[model samples]
Target: MERIPILRMGKFLLITIQVDMHDTTALALQDDLMAKIARSGARGVLIDISALDVVDSYIGRMIADISMMSKLLHARTVLVGMRPAVAITLVELGLSLRGVKTALDVEKGMELLAAALEDGDAADQD
Candidate 1:
Protein backbone atom coordinates (compact mmCIF):
# COMPACT_ATOMS: atom_id res chain seq x y z
CA MET A 1 0.00 0.00 0.00
CA GLU A 2 1.24 3.46 -0.84
CA ARG A 3 1.25 6.13 1.84
CA ILE A 4 1.80 9.87 1.74
CA PRO A 5 4.60 11.31 3.81
CA ILE A 6 3.52 13.73 6.53
CA LEU A 7 6.37 15.79 7.88
CA ARG A 8 6.41 17.46 11.25
CA MET A 9 7.48 21.08 11.35
CA GLY A 10 7.52 22.23 14.95
CA LYS A 11 3.84 22.35 15.91
CA PHE A 12 2.60 21.82 12.38
CA LEU A 13 2.33 18.97 9.88
CA LEU A 14 3.35 19.56 6.26
CA ILE A 15 2.10 17.41 3.40
CA THR A 16 3.30 17.91 -0.16
CA ILE A 17 1.37 15.90 -2.69
CA GLN A 18 3.92 14.92 -5.30
CA VAL A 19 1.88 12.18 -6.96
CA ASP A 20 -1.55 11.92 -8.46
CA MET A 21 -3.88 10.64 -5.76
CA HIS A 22 -6.23 7.77 -6.19
CA ASP A 23 -9.19 7.24 -3.89
CA THR A 24 -7.42 4.73 -1.71
CA THR A 25 -4.39 6.95 -1.41
CA ALA A 26 -6.49 9.90 -0.33
CA LEU A 27 -8.37 7.80 2.20
CA ALA A 28 -5.14 6.52 3.63
CA LEU A 29 -3.85 10.08 3.90
CA GLN A 30 -6.90 11.15 5.85
CA ASP A 31 -6.48 8.31 8.29
CA ASP A 32 -2.74 8.80 8.60
CA LEU A 33 -3.06 12.54 9.11
CA MET A 34 -5.67 12.23 11.83
CA ALA A 35 -3.52 9.75 13.69
CA LYS A 36 -0.47 11.95 13.25
CA ILE A 37 -2.31 14.93 14.66
CA ALA A 38 -3.52 13.00 17.68
CA ARG A 39 -0.12 11.52 18.41
CA SER A 40 2.02 14.56 17.62
CA GLY A 41 -0.36 17.18 19.00
CA ALA A 42 0.19 19.29 15.91
CA ARG A 43 -1.78 22.50 15.92
CA GLY A 44 -1.86 23.06 12.16
CA VAL A 45 -1.63 21.24 8.82
CA LEU A 46 -0.22 22.68 5.60
CA ILE A 47 -0.93 20.83 2.37
CA ASP A 48 0.77 21.79 -0.89
CA ILE A 49 -0.87 20.50 -4.05
CA SER A 50 1.20 22.41 -6.60
CA ALA A 51 2.40 19.19 -8.20
CA LEU A 52 -1.09 18.12 -9.09
CA ASP A 53 -2.34 19.32 -12.45
CA VAL A 54 -5.77 17.77 -12.15
CA VAL A 55 -8.40 17.00 -9.56
CA ASP A 56 -11.54 14.96 -9.78
CA SER A 57 -14.56 15.25 -7.53
CA TYR A 58 -13.43 12.47 -5.23
CA ILE A 59 -10.08 14.08 -4.61
CA GLY A 60 -11.66 17.47 -4.11
CA ARG A 61 -14.11 16.09 -1.58
CA MET A 62 -11.33 14.23 0.13
CA ILE A 63 -9.40 17.46 0.51
CA ALA A 64 -12.40 19.12 2.07
CA ASP A 65 -13.01 16.14 4.32
CA ILE A 66 -9.40 16.15 5.43
CA SER A 67 -9.64 19.80 6.39
CA MET A 68 -12.83 19.23 8.33
CA MET A 69 -11.45 16.17 10.08
CA SER A 70 -8.32 18.08 11.05
CA LYS A 71 -10.48 20.71 12.64
CA LEU A 72 -12.33 18.05 14.57
CA LEU A 73 -8.96 16.89 15.82
CA HIS A 74 -8.16 20.46 16.90
CA ALA A 75 -5.80 21.31 14.05
CA ARG A 76 -6.09 24.09 11.51
CA THR A 77 -5.60 23.03 7.88
CA VAL A 78 -4.31 25.27 5.10
CA LEU A 79 -4.32 24.15 1.48
CA VAL A 80 -1.82 25.80 -0.84
CA GLY A 81 -0.69 25.95 -4.44
CA MET A 82 -3.98 25.28 -6.14
CA ARG A 83 -4.03 25.81 -9.87
CA PRO A 84 -6.84 27.83 -11.42
CA ALA A 85 -8.19 24.90 -13.41
CA VAL A 86 -8.22 22.69 -10.37
CA ALA A 87 -10.12 25.35 -8.48
CA ILE A 88 -12.60 25.57 -11.31
CA THR A 89 -13.00 21.82 -11.35
CA LEU A 90 -13.69 21.74 -7.63
CA VAL A 91 -16.27 24.46 -7.99
CA GLU A 92 -17.83 22.76 -10.96
CA LEU A 93 -18.05 19.57 -9.00
CA GLY A 94 -19.84 21.52 -6.23
CA LEU A 95 -17.24 20.90 -3.59
CA SER A 96 -16.98 24.32 -2.07
CA LEU A 97 -14.35 23.22 0.48
CA ARG A 98 -16.06 25.62 2.80
CA GLY A 99 -13.92 25.17 5.90
CA VAL A 100 -10.56 24.84 4.28
CA LYS A 101 -8.17 27.74 4.43
CA THR A 102 -6.16 28.40 1.28
CA ALA A 103 -3.03 30.29 0.28
CA LEU A 104 -1.29 30.98 -2.98
CA ASP A 105 1.94 29.29 -1.89
CA VAL A 106 3.61 27.41 0.89
CA GLU A 107 5.20 30.51 2.42
CA LYS A 108 1.83 32.17 2.82
CA GLY A 109 0.30 28.94 3.99
CA MET A 110 2.93 28.64 6.66
CA GLU A 111 2.28 32.19 7.74
CA LEU A 112 -1.43 31.50 7.94
CA LEU A 113 -0.87 28.41 10.00
CA ALA A 114 1.47 30.27 12.32
CA ALA A 115 -0.99 33.07 12.81
CA ALA A 116 -3.80 30.63 13.39
CA LEU A 117 -1.77 28.82 16.00
CA GLU A 118 -1.00 32.08 17.71
CA ASP A 119 -4.68 32.91 17.73
CA GLY A 120 -5.46 29.55 19.20
CA ASP A 121 -2.91 30.12 21.92
CA ALA A 122 -4.37 33.49 22.71
CA ALA A 123 -7.82 31.96 22.90
CA ASP A 124 -6.53 29.32 25.24
CA GLN A 125 -5.30 32.00 27.61
CA ASP A 126 -8.71 33.56 27.87
Candidate 2:
Protein backbone atom coordinates (compact mmCIF):
# COMPACT_ATOMS: atom_id res chain seq x y z
CA MET A 1 0.00 0.00 0.00
CA GLU A 2 1.30 3.46 -0.84
CA ARG A 3 0.38 6.77 0.65
CA ILE A 4 -1.36 9.45 -1.38
CA PRO A 5 0.40 12.75 -0.87
CA ILE A 6 -1.56 15.97 -1.11
CA LEU A 7 -0.05 19.43 -1.32
CA ARG A 8 -1.56 22.86 -1.41
CA MET A 9 -0.42 25.06 -4.27
CA GLY A 10 -1.88 28.52 -4.40
CA LYS A 11 -5.65 27.95 -4.45
CA PHE A 12 -5.36 24.46 -5.87
CA LEU A 13 -4.46 21.20 -4.23
CA LEU A 14 -1.84 19.05 -5.89
CA ILE A 15 -2.27 15.36 -5.14
CA THR A 16 0.40 12.80 -5.91
CA ILE A 17 -1.16 9.38 -5.76
CA GLN A 18 0.78 6.16 -6.10
CA VAL A 19 -1.08 3.32 -7.72
CA ASP A 20 0.23 -0.16 -8.29
CA MET A 21 -1.48 -0.35 -11.66
CA HIS A 22 -4.28 -1.90 -9.68
CA ASP A 23 -7.92 -0.93 -9.65
CA THR A 24 -8.57 -1.45 -5.95
CA THR A 25 -5.84 0.91 -4.88
CA ALA A 26 -6.82 3.45 -7.49
CA LEU A 27 -10.44 3.47 -6.37
CA ALA A 28 -9.44 3.84 -2.76
CA LEU A 29 -7.17 6.68 -3.67
CA GLN A 30 -9.95 8.37 -5.56
CA ASP A 31 -12.28 8.22 -2.57
CA ASP A 32 -9.59 9.52 -0.25
CA LEU A 33 -8.74 12.34 -2.63
CA MET A 34 -12.35 13.34 -2.94
CA ALA A 35 -12.71 13.47 0.81
CA LYS A 36 -9.62 15.63 1.12
CA ILE A 37 -10.75 17.96 -1.62
CA ALA A 38 -14.09 18.46 0.08
CA ARG A 39 -12.42 19.11 3.39
CA SER A 40 -9.81 21.53 2.08
CA GLY A 41 -12.19 23.60 -0.05
CA ALA A 42 -9.62 23.89 -2.81
CA ARG A 43 -10.39 25.88 -5.92
CA GLY A 44 -8.81 23.30 -8.22
CA VAL A 45 -6.97 20.00 -8.16
CA LEU A 46 -3.87 18.82 -10.07
CA ILE A 47 -3.24 15.10 -10.21
CA ASP A 48 0.29 14.06 -11.18
CA ILE A 49 0.37 10.71 -12.93
CA SER A 50 3.89 10.79 -14.26
CA ALA A 51 4.76 7.68 -12.31
CA LEU A 52 2.09 5.44 -13.76
CA ASP A 53 3.22 3.16 -16.56
CA VAL A 54 -0.20 1.89 -17.51
CA VAL A 55 -3.82 2.74 -16.92
CA ASP A 56 -6.71 0.33 -17.08
CA SER A 57 -10.47 0.68 -17.35
CA TYR A 58 -11.11 0.71 -13.62
CA ILE A 59 -8.42 3.30 -13.05
CA GLY A 60 -9.83 5.36 -15.87
CA ARG A 61 -13.25 5.24 -14.25
CA MET A 62 -11.70 6.29 -10.97
CA ILE A 63 -10.07 9.25 -12.65
CA ALA A 64 -13.35 10.22 -14.18
CA ASP A 65 -15.05 9.87 -10.83
CA ILE A 66 -12.47 12.10 -9.22
CA SER A 67 -13.06 14.75 -11.84
CA MET A 68 -16.79 14.62 -11.19
CA MET A 69 -16.26 14.74 -7.45
CA SER A 70 -14.03 17.75 -7.81
CA LYS A 71 -16.74 19.62 -9.65
CA LEU A 72 -19.26 18.67 -7.00
CA LEU A 73 -16.88 20.13 -4.44
CA HIS A 74 -16.75 23.35 -6.42
CA ALA A 75 -13.20 22.60 -7.50
CA ARG A 76 -11.94 21.62 -10.93
CA THR A 77 -9.64 18.66 -11.43
CA VAL A 78 -6.80 18.58 -13.95
CA LEU A 79 -4.76 15.45 -14.58
CA VAL A 80 -1.14 16.40 -15.13
CA GLY A 81 2.09 14.81 -16.23
CA MET A 82 0.66 11.72 -17.85
CA ARG A 83 3.18 9.58 -19.67
CA PRO A 84 2.84 9.44 -23.44
CA ALA A 85 2.60 5.70 -23.48
CA VAL A 86 -0.09 5.66 -20.85
CA ALA A 87 -2.03 8.30 -22.73
CA ILE A 88 -1.84 6.32 -25.91
CA THR A 89 -2.93 3.19 -24.12
CA LEU A 90 -5.92 4.90 -22.58
CA VAL A 91 -6.92 6.36 -25.90
CA GLU A 92 -6.61 3.06 -27.70
CA LEU A 93 -8.67 1.32 -25.07
CA GLY A 94 -11.53 3.67 -25.84
CA LEU A 95 -11.52 4.95 -22.28
CA SER A 96 -12.66 8.43 -22.99
CA LEU A 97 -12.26 10.96 -20.21
CA ARG A 98 -14.86 13.25 -21.65
CA GLY A 99 -15.52 15.74 -18.87
CA VAL A 100 -12.05 15.66 -17.38
CA LYS A 101 -9.38 18.22 -18.07
CA THR A 102 -5.74 17.30 -18.58
CA ALA A 103 -2.38 18.97 -19.13
CA LEU A 104 1.05 17.88 -20.17
CA ASP A 105 2.69 19.25 -17.01
CA VAL A 106 1.85 20.47 -13.59
CA GLU A 107 2.99 24.03 -14.25
CA LYS A 108 0.72 24.37 -17.23
CA GLY A 109 -2.12 22.72 -15.37
CA MET A 110 -1.73 25.10 -12.47
CA GLU A 111 -1.62 28.07 -14.80
CA LEU A 112 -4.81 26.92 -16.47
CA LEU A 113 -6.47 26.28 -13.15
CA ALA A 114 -5.50 29.72 -11.88
CA ALA A 115 -6.85 31.33 -14.97
CA ALA A 116 -10.10 29.42 -14.60
CA LEU A 117 -10.45 30.51 -11.03
CA GLU A 118 -9.73 34.06 -11.99
CA ASP A 119 -12.35 33.96 -14.69
CA GLY A 120 -14.84 32.47 -12.30
CA ASP A 121 -14.14 35.19 -9.78
CA ALA A 122 -14.49 37.90 -12.36
CA ALA A 123 -17.76 36.47 -13.53
CA ASP A 124 -19.05 36.29 -10.00
CA GLN A 125 -18.17 39.95 -9.45
CA ASP A 126 -20.34 40.96 -12.36
Candidate 3:
Protein backbone atom coordinates (compact mmCIF):
# COMPACT_ATOMS: atom_id res chain seq x y z
CA MET A 1 0.00 0.00 0.00
CA GLU A 2 1.35 3.37 -0.99
CA ARG A 3 0.87 6.26 1.40
CA ILE A 4 1.19 9.98 0.97
CA PRO A 5 4.01 11.56 2.88
CA ILE A 6 3.08 14.00 5.62
CA LEU A 7 5.91 16.16 6.86
CA ARG A 8 5.84 17.83 10.25
CA MET A 9 7.31 21.30 10.31
CA GLY A 10 7.37 22.94 13.69
CA LYS A 11 3.68 23.22 14.57
CA PHE A 12 2.45 22.56 11.06
CA LEU A 13 1.94 19.46 8.89
CA LEU A 14 2.74 19.84 5.21
CA ILE A 15 1.30 17.45 2.62
CA THR A 16 2.06 17.60 -1.05
CA ILE A 17 -0.22 15.47 -3.21
CA GLN A 18 1.67 14.43 -6.30
CA VAL A 19 -0.24 11.41 -7.55
CA ASP A 20 -3.68 10.53 -8.75
CA MET A 21 -6.11 10.32 -5.83
CA HIS A 22 -7.88 7.07 -5.20
CA ASP A 23 -10.60 6.13 -2.70
CA THR A 24 -8.38 4.02 -0.51
CA THR A 25 -5.51 6.51 -0.62
CA ALA A 26 -7.80 9.39 0.25
CA LEU A 27 -9.28 7.52 3.21
CA ALA A 28 -5.84 6.56 4.41
CA LEU A 29 -4.61 10.11 4.14
CA GLN A 30 -7.57 11.40 6.13
CA ASP A 31 -7.01 8.90 8.91
CA ASP A 32 -3.26 9.35 8.92
CA LEU A 33 -3.49 13.14 8.92
CA MET A 34 -5.95 13.16 11.82
CA ALA A 35 -3.71 10.89 13.85
CA LYS A 36 -0.66 13.02 13.10
CA ILE A 37 -2.43 16.19 14.13
CA ALA A 38 -3.47 14.60 17.42
CA ARG A 39 -0.10 13.01 18.18
CA SER A 40 2.10 15.87 16.97
CA GLY A 41 -0.04 18.62 18.50
CA ALA A 42 0.09 20.43 15.20
CA ARG A 43 -1.66 23.79 14.98
CA GLY A 44 -2.01 23.89 11.21
CA VAL A 45 -2.16 21.77 8.01
CA LEU A 46 -0.94 22.84 4.56
CA ILE A 47 -2.05 20.67 1.64
CA ASP A 48 -0.29 21.36 -1.66
CA ILE A 49 -2.05 20.07 -4.75
CA SER A 50 0.01 21.86 -7.34
CA ALA A 51 0.84 18.66 -9.17
CA LEU A 52 -2.71 17.54 -9.55
CA ASP A 53 -4.21 18.77 -12.79
CA VAL A 54 -7.65 17.32 -12.25
CA VAL A 55 -9.92 17.01 -9.24
CA ASP A 56 -13.08 14.97 -9.31
CA SER A 57 -15.97 15.41 -6.90
CA TYR A 58 -14.69 12.66 -4.66
CA ILE A 59 -11.34 14.33 -4.36
CA GLY A 60 -13.02 17.62 -3.67
CA ARG A 61 -15.12 16.11 -0.90
CA MET A 62 -12.08 14.42 0.56
CA ILE A 63 -10.27 17.74 0.70
CA ALA A 64 -13.23 19.31 2.43
CA ASP A 65 -13.50 16.42 4.87
CA ILE A 66 -9.83 16.66 5.73
CA SER A 67 -10.14 20.36 6.40
CA MET A 68 -13.22 19.87 8.58
CA MET A 69 -11.64 17.01 10.49
CA SER A 70 -8.46 19.01 11.09
CA LYS A 71 -10.58 21.89 12.35
CA LEU A 72 -12.29 19.58 14.80
CA LEU A 73 -8.84 18.40 15.88
CA HIS A 74 -7.97 22.06 16.63
CA ALA A 75 -5.79 22.54 13.54
CA ARG A 76 -6.31 25.02 10.74
CA THR A 77 -6.15 23.73 7.12
CA VAL A 78 -4.88 25.76 4.18
CA LEU A 79 -5.11 24.27 0.67
CA VAL A 80 -2.66 25.69 -1.83
CA GLY A 81 -1.52 25.29 -5.47
CA MET A 82 -4.92 24.64 -6.94
CA ARG A 83 -5.11 24.70 -10.70
CA PRO A 84 -7.76 26.81 -12.40
CA ALA A 85 -9.70 23.85 -13.81
CA VAL A 86 -9.54 22.05 -10.53
CA ALA A 87 -11.03 25.05 -8.80
CA ILE A 88 -13.77 25.22 -11.39
CA THR A 89 -14.61 21.56 -10.89
CA LEU A 90 -14.87 22.04 -7.15
CA VAL A 91 -17.31 24.88 -7.64
CA GLU A 92 -19.26 22.95 -10.24
CA LEU A 93 -19.61 20.05 -7.85
CA GLY A 94 -20.85 22.44 -5.16
CA LEU A 95 -18.11 21.42 -2.79
CA SER A 96 -17.62 24.90 -1.49
CA LEU A 97 -15.05 23.65 1.01
CA ARG A 98 -16.40 26.07 3.51
CA GLY A 99 -14.10 27.08 6.35
CA VAL A 100 -11.04 25.86 4.43
CA LYS A 101 -8.40 28.53 3.87
CA THR A 102 -6.66 28.71 0.50
CA ALA A 103 -3.53 30.28 -0.96
CA LEU A 104 -1.94 30.61 -4.35
CA ASP A 105 1.17 28.77 -3.26
CA VAL A 106 2.86 26.97 -0.39
CA GLU A 107 4.68 30.08 0.89
CA LYS A 108 1.46 32.05 1.14
CA GLY A 109 -0.27 29.11 2.72
CA MET A 110 2.40 28.88 5.39
CA GLU A 111 2.11 32.58 6.04
CA LEU A 112 -1.65 32.29 6.33
CA LEU A 113 -1.31 29.45 8.80
CA ALA A 114 1.31 31.33 10.80
CA ALA A 115 -0.86 34.43 11.06
CA ALA A 116 -3.84 32.36 12.07
CA LEU A 117 -1.83 30.55 14.68
CA GLU A 118 -0.52 33.83 16.03
CA ASP A 119 -4.04 35.16 16.23
CA GLY A 120 -5.11 32.04 18.03
CA ASP A 121 -2.33 32.46 20.52
CA ALA A 122 -3.29 36.07 21.12
CA ALA A 123 -6.86 35.01 21.72
CA ASP A 124 -5.70 32.36 24.12
CA GLN A 125 -3.76 34.98 26.07
CA ASP A 126 -6.78 37.26 26.24
Candidate 4:
Protein backbone atom coordinates (compact mmCIF):
# COMPACT_ATOMS: atom_id res chain seq x y z
CA MET A 1 0.00 0.00 0.00
CA GLU A 2 1.36 3.37 -1.00
CA ARG A 3 1.13 6.04 1.65
CA ILE A 4 1.31 9.81 1.40
CA PRO A 5 3.30 11.63 4.02
CA ILE A 6 1.53 14.21 6.16
CA LEU A 7 3.85 16.95 7.29
CA ARG A 8 3.09 19.10 10.28
CA MET A 9 3.65 22.84 9.93
CA GLY A 10 2.89 24.40 13.27
CA LYS A 11 -0.89 23.84 13.48
CA PHE A 12 -1.37 22.79 9.88
CA LEU A 13 -0.87 19.65 7.85
CA LEU A 14 0.73 19.95 4.43
CA ILE A 15 0.07 17.30 1.82
CA THR A 16 1.45 17.35 -1.69
CA ILE A 17 -0.12 14.93 -4.12
CA GLN A 18 2.55 14.51 -6.75
CA VAL A 19 1.24 11.48 -8.55
CA ASP A 20 -1.84 10.51 -10.48
CA MET A 21 -3.16 8.46 -7.62
CA HIS A 22 -5.11 5.29 -7.92
CA ASP A 23 -8.46 4.89 -6.19
CA THR A 24 -6.93 2.79 -3.45
CA THR A 25 -4.19 5.31 -2.96
CA ALA A 26 -6.75 8.06 -2.64
CA LEU A 27 -8.70 6.05 -0.09
CA ALA A 28 -5.55 5.45 1.88
CA LEU A 29 -4.76 9.13 1.82
CA GLN A 30 -8.21 9.96 3.19
CA ASP A 31 -7.70 7.54 6.04
CA ASP A 32 -4.16 8.63 6.80
CA LEU A 33 -5.09 12.29 6.72
CA MET A 34 -7.93 11.82 9.14
CA ALA A 35 -5.67 9.96 11.51
CA LYS A 36 -2.98 12.61 11.23
CA ILE A 37 -5.46 15.39 11.90
CA ALA A 38 -6.68 13.64 15.02
CA ARG A 39 -3.21 12.79 16.23
CA SER A 40 -1.60 16.13 15.48
CA GLY A 41 -4.61 18.27 16.44
CA ALA A 42 -4.07 20.16 13.23
CA ARG A 43 -6.13 23.26 12.62
CA GLY A 44 -5.92 23.15 8.85
CA VAL A 45 -5.03 20.99 5.84
CA LEU A 46 -3.33 22.30 2.69
CA ILE A 47 -3.30 19.95 -0.27
CA ASP A 48 -1.09 20.82 -3.24
CA ILE A 49 -2.26 19.37 -6.51
CA SER A 50 -0.13 21.34 -8.93
CA ALA A 51 1.67 18.32 -10.32
CA LEU A 52 -1.50 16.53 -11.23
CA ASP A 53 -2.87 16.96 -14.71
CA VAL A 54 -5.95 14.81 -14.27
CA VAL A 55 -9.02 15.59 -12.21
CA ASP A 56 -11.54 12.89 -12.85
CA SER A 57 -14.89 12.74 -11.08
CA TYR A 58 -13.63 10.18 -8.59
CA ILE A 59 -10.68 12.31 -7.60
CA GLY A 60 -12.92 15.34 -7.32
CA ARG A 61 -15.31 13.49 -5.01
CA MET A 62 -12.39 12.27 -2.92
CA ILE A 63 -11.19 15.83 -2.48
CA ALA A 64 -14.67 16.93 -1.44
CA ASP A 65 -14.98 14.10 1.03
CA ILE A 66 -11.56 14.85 2.50
CA SER A 67 -12.54 18.47 2.97
CA MET A 68 -15.82 17.61 4.65
CA MET A 69 -14.18 15.05 6.85
CA SER A 70 -11.49 17.49 7.87
CA LYS A 71 -14.14 20.04 8.75
CA LEU A 72 -15.95 17.48 10.89
CA LEU A 73 -12.67 16.92 12.71
CA HIS A 74 -12.30 20.66 13.37
CA ALA A 75 -9.84 21.42 10.60
CA ARG A 76 -10.16 23.60 7.50
CA THR A 77 -9.17 22.07 4.15
CA VAL A 78 -7.74 24.14 1.31
CA LEU A 79 -6.77 22.82 -2.10
CA VAL A 80 -3.99 24.66 -3.86
CA GLY A 81 -2.10 24.77 -7.16
CA MET A 82 -4.80 23.42 -9.41
CA ARG A 83 -4.08 23.77 -13.11
CA PRO A 84 -6.48 25.61 -15.39
CA ALA A 85 -7.25 22.53 -17.45
CA VAL A 86 -7.98 20.46 -14.39
CA ALA A 87 -10.19 23.19 -13.00
CA ILE A 88 -12.14 23.32 -16.23
CA THR A 89 -12.51 19.56 -16.23
CA LEU A 90 -13.90 19.61 -12.73
CA VAL A 91 -16.31 22.36 -13.66
CA GLU A 92 -17.51 20.52 -16.72
CA LEU A 93 -18.06 17.46 -14.57
CA GLY A 94 -20.30 19.55 -12.30
CA LEU A 95 -18.21 19.10 -9.15
CA SER A 96 -18.25 22.52 -7.58
CA LEU A 97 -16.48 21.42 -4.37
CA ARG A 98 -19.23 23.40 -2.74
CA GLY A 99 -17.72 23.59 0.73
CA VAL A 100 -14.02 23.30 -0.05
CA LYS A 101 -11.77 26.36 -0.16
CA THR A 102 -8.93 26.78 -2.65
CA ALA A 103 -5.80 28.81 -3.32
CA LEU A 104 -3.68 29.54 -6.35
CA ASP A 105 -0.51 28.11 -4.82
CA VAL A 106 1.18 26.95 -1.62
CA GLU A 107 2.07 30.37 -0.30
CA LYS A 108 -1.45 31.72 -0.85
CA GLY A 109 -2.88 28.52 0.50
CA MET A 110 -0.94 28.94 3.71
CA GLU A 111 -2.15 32.52 3.96
CA LEU A 112 -5.71 31.46 3.39
CA LEU A 113 -5.48 28.70 5.95
CA ALA A 114 -3.88 31.05 8.43
CA ALA A 115 -6.66 33.58 7.99
CA ALA A 116 -9.26 30.88 8.41
CA LEU A 117 -7.58 29.57 11.55
CA GLU A 118 -7.37 33.08 12.90
CA ASP A 119 -11.06 33.54 12.29
CA GLY A 120 -11.78 30.26 14.00
CA ASP A 121 -9.65 31.21 16.95
CA ALA A 122 -11.40 34.53 17.21
CA ALA A 123 -14.81 32.88 17.17
CA ASP A 124 -13.75 30.45 19.86
CA GLN A 125 -12.55 33.31 22.02
CA ASP A 126 -15.99 34.93 21.86
- For every model in order, what is the number of clashing pairs? 0, 0, 0, 0
lDDT of each: 0.92, 0.84, 0.93, 0.93
lDDT of 4 by residue, 61-103 (tens): 9999999999999999999999999998888889888988999
Q: Which segments of candidate 2 are over 4 A away from where they belong? A: 19-21
Candidate 1 ranges beyond 4 A from true positions: none
Q: How do the residues 1-126 of candidate 3 rate in per-residue lDDT, one tens digit apiece?
A: 779999999999999999997789988999999999999999999999999998887888899899999999999999999999888888887877787789999999999999999999999999
Residue 121, model 4: Cα distance from true site in angstroms? 0.9
lDDT of 1: 0.92
TM-score of each: 0.95, 0.90, 0.96, 0.97
Alpha-carbon RMSD, candidate 4:
0.7
How well does candidate 1 match the true structure in TM-score terms? Answer: 0.95
Task: Give the top-scoring candidate (TM-score).
Answer: 4
Residue 64 lDDT (model 4): 96
- Model 2, C-alpha of 95: deviation from truth (Å): 0.8
